[model samples]
Target: MKLARLGVLIDEAAMKRLHSYGLNVFERYIEEILEHAGAPFETITDIRALDDRGFDIVIASVVPENEETAERLWQYAEHGGTLIAYGGLGLLARRLGCRQRPRTGAGYARLPEFRSVPAPLRCLSAQPWHAEDAGAGAIGALHASSPQGELVGPALQTFAVGRGAIHRWAVDIPTTVVQLQQGTRPVLHDGIPAPDGTADIDEGILKADDDIELDWEWDREKTATGMPYFAYPHADYWREALMAHLVRCALAKDRTLPLLDYWPEGTGHVALISFDSDFNEDERAVVTLDVLKKLQIPSTWCMIEPGYSPQVYERVLAEGHELALHYNALEKENGIWSLEEFTRQRQWVQSATGLARVVSNKNHYTRYEGWGELFRWCEANGIAADQTRGPTKRGNVGFLFGTCHPYFPIAWCDEGNRRYDVLEIGFLTQDLNHPNLSDTTVIEPFLKQVAKVGGVAHFLFHQIHIHRLEPVRQAIREVVGKARQMGFAFWTSKQINDWQRARRTMRVTGIDAAGQVRLERGTVNEPVAVWLPTSEAPESIQSPGIVYRYGVPCIKQVHHLTREEAEC
Candidate 1:
């Protein structure tokens, strides 16, 4: 459907409570979810200024201070508007036909449809208030204990209004928002001793076992039915579930529009074969490059140091592969780098490669502390994108933000909730993470998931690992073959970054009363894919650089044009 106009009511008093509770109070995570879902929204602090005609859906987290505010919200819903109220908003519950009781002890919940993999949600300390009304339908079932306990009540609910509806999430939405936005869990201990037991690898460099394995389980039935399985409790699945609910609410109000797809040209999925050049051996790097060349895959090579073999860089460029910076600082003390160091190192690579700019990078050792500053540094230094959003620990591999697609990160620490200029390409799978690299099966499930969602299949491989370990090479080869078989379009990191940048700025300017669609080109010249939800496919289509593909739904793409015209 057409992008839904959303409005979030900000309650100052609710902010105070959330802050006093030591939970994250920002709405940036919600905005990020909307942006990725292609739903445009605005924030409203003054309840009087809210216009039901303006927003198709309105979300509020605080209880109304007086009867007037509650009456206004009730009137809006009565006029066929969607209202989503988070817990702690007792007035909203009564208006939506539910009775909110006193808060209960900490517990867990089972959200089956909320995620591909249904994980038991452990609502520590801030257990949701129990609902006492029979009209409230359960969205999630609560457990009495932490991990697994006896059934208690509904953790989330929905109730019907006059001509609209209200979705009440019993648990704390802000807490989940904060956890998803920060992307990093609390550092439990001083350090994790390496397998060899020589010394600890600093706390932030790798995630603790508890953080990685958060009691998440795969849904066997869903898997058997060929549904995508995203690891639950991971930020991505939660974000996905939240957005899906929001979209469902919007669609319930109106269902005559089309939803946006992540990729262009209606491609099933995109693949990036990346290699981190962290070692000192030029021969090893060359060997890995040879393997890629033989596979006919255009990969991205992230160089760790400045002075790599000139021949290697030259060959990479000549073979149509991309050269990117792998910003390296092996020592724990150097987690955050100075802007001067960033500029100098990036410049050195640019000078050697003879390219005007180097847009892609992955931090050495995956040192991701000070990410907000690092991304700002990337923008300042003209770096267009980064792939350092992966989990710090090697053994744990999954989406940190619950997506395999590239997105502009909402500046977590920035005021005014601004977004970063640099695009974040989520890491899909890595070579060094697995105990045995020969087990090509480690990535099969993930690849299948990405393909199911038509997401980006980003694969990170260390050149040294591939050169030293035969299994690593075999694994890469097998994965590459599998992706090709699955109909994934192979791309360099820069290509993915460029396409995402263009898509982010692209917009639908208008649809005339006569049903003609108007468009505006984004900042880039890349082709844009326009997905139109239609009941029946057009017999034939006519437009420059535009192609129509029919499936359960169909999408139209208009490419290489500053301006174009189309009819649905």
Candidate 2:
């Protein structure tokens, strides 16, 4: 089956509105969602090309330029192509049997059951619509508190049209994605000051052996930042829905488009064990390394250049562990770090480790402001991956951007939009964020979520803290033990980075009607998992790599080096 060619109508005016507010609104998020779903699409800016005969389906935000373009959209929908319009496009709404009501201020809505689970839908501002007529049905609903009190209405509606269909969404999906991507959340009035007398708006800190209590405040109106409110807890839900809807639309037009497998080689889940060399204590570092050695697990040590010594660097390399940089500001004021200083640190680490280039890094304190410049530095310096997207403190913990998967970070600038070459391997769980460092059970919930999604379970452990705090050590041990028992493949950060980079480069050049798939290009000498959307299992498998799973097609490329040649 050939891939469906999706046409996305770009609304210049709507894009301008987002850019005016320093947001990289639409394209990147849409591309990411589509790519993850294995859906191929192209952008159409000219309204003259909005013909029903041109594309299998056309998607446009409610903010169309003029009446002419809007009319063209109607014709496109009425003639014979699936039209998906978001927000309150009057013509599209009426055609979809939906009537738009008054605006419901920014709030969160409970999505209808997706994959048998009710996910939360967070919107800055939502326009409620309902399917009141036949030949149409509500797919999802938005639940919000309004002036008339609590109300529920269709957030997504579908209607059958002449030889085609119209899918309308009341919630602003692009805006939500942009907000989550930027980590922009409205300031909640429930503010608490840090011990240093600074305002700690969204940060929480937990000590070792402390009580485990989870509190999520959902008062929509109480925000200090004056920004529109968004639901952070289920950001991934909204993203998943956006992708699912795109796939559904494509399938409706043509069902031959194959769904991409999430993990490489159809592995259920992946685990990454990493340590932040924040403290320069060699003994503490040795203790942590000793534990990992006993478990026979290879971990990535993100070493601080200033805190690192020749002895420790040699020891880590000799033990068959991965070495990465923990880039930190040499002289810091207000958490800001200079690019030149970062380069100096990188050179220092390279000189000490005797490696010409480093592939991975995590910012000290995760203070990643001036990200555009920071990422530019990474690309220029040959850094391939980063883990700085994790929460800096306890308060801001939990899935930021709602995904545990790695993606190319979008760089939003006044000049234009660009995606960096570096991969952002996000940290899903961290030991310091919890109040009870000794409590290993806190991490199980995160592990469970990742397993449920077949996502990466990346853990962050600080060497100094783990050595000083026995509970932290215990917690790490328990989490690792449970994850092993659950069948997670433990990998170093570099290994995961290599696999993801290869996966992104890989392409399914062709698939025939008989379901025979062909890969034209991919990472050479690297293992990859190819997903085939067929009930009948695959036969006549051909590859040099070992097949971990036959049906789903998890293949490890034949390694040229001997066991002694490769790091153990």
- Show how many residue pairs clash in every candidate, following the order shown: 6, 7
- The C-alpha TM-scores of every prediction are 0.78, 0.79
**Per-residue error (Å), model 1, residue 325:** 1.5
Q: Pick the candidate with the highest TM-score.
A: 2
Candidate lDDT scores, in order, read: 0.62, 0.61
lDDT of 2 by residue, 1-568 (tens): 3556677777566666667778655443555655655455677756676773377777775244557766787777778888787665775556456676887765556645344233555566677776678667677566665322365676777777778777777776765655555444322222333233222433332111011111234412112422111113354556666655665565455443344455555356788888888767889888988888787778888878556667877878888788998887533432336677778878877887888888899877565554366678888788999887664444334454455767666666463455778877777546742453213434666677677655678888888877787777777788778888887888877888787666555455556665455553344343344543322223544544323221223233312323443444
lDDT of 1 by residue, 483-512 (tens): 888888889889988777666665565445
Off by over 4 Å in 2: 1-3, 11-24, 61-64, 88-99, 130-135, 145-149, 185-215, 218-233, 330-336, 370-373, 392-396, 413-415, 432-438, 524-568
Clashing pairs in 2: 187-224, 203-395, 204-395, 206-435, 265-529, 265-554, 545-556
Task: Find the 10 residues in a row with the least total lDDT in model 2.
Answer: 206-215
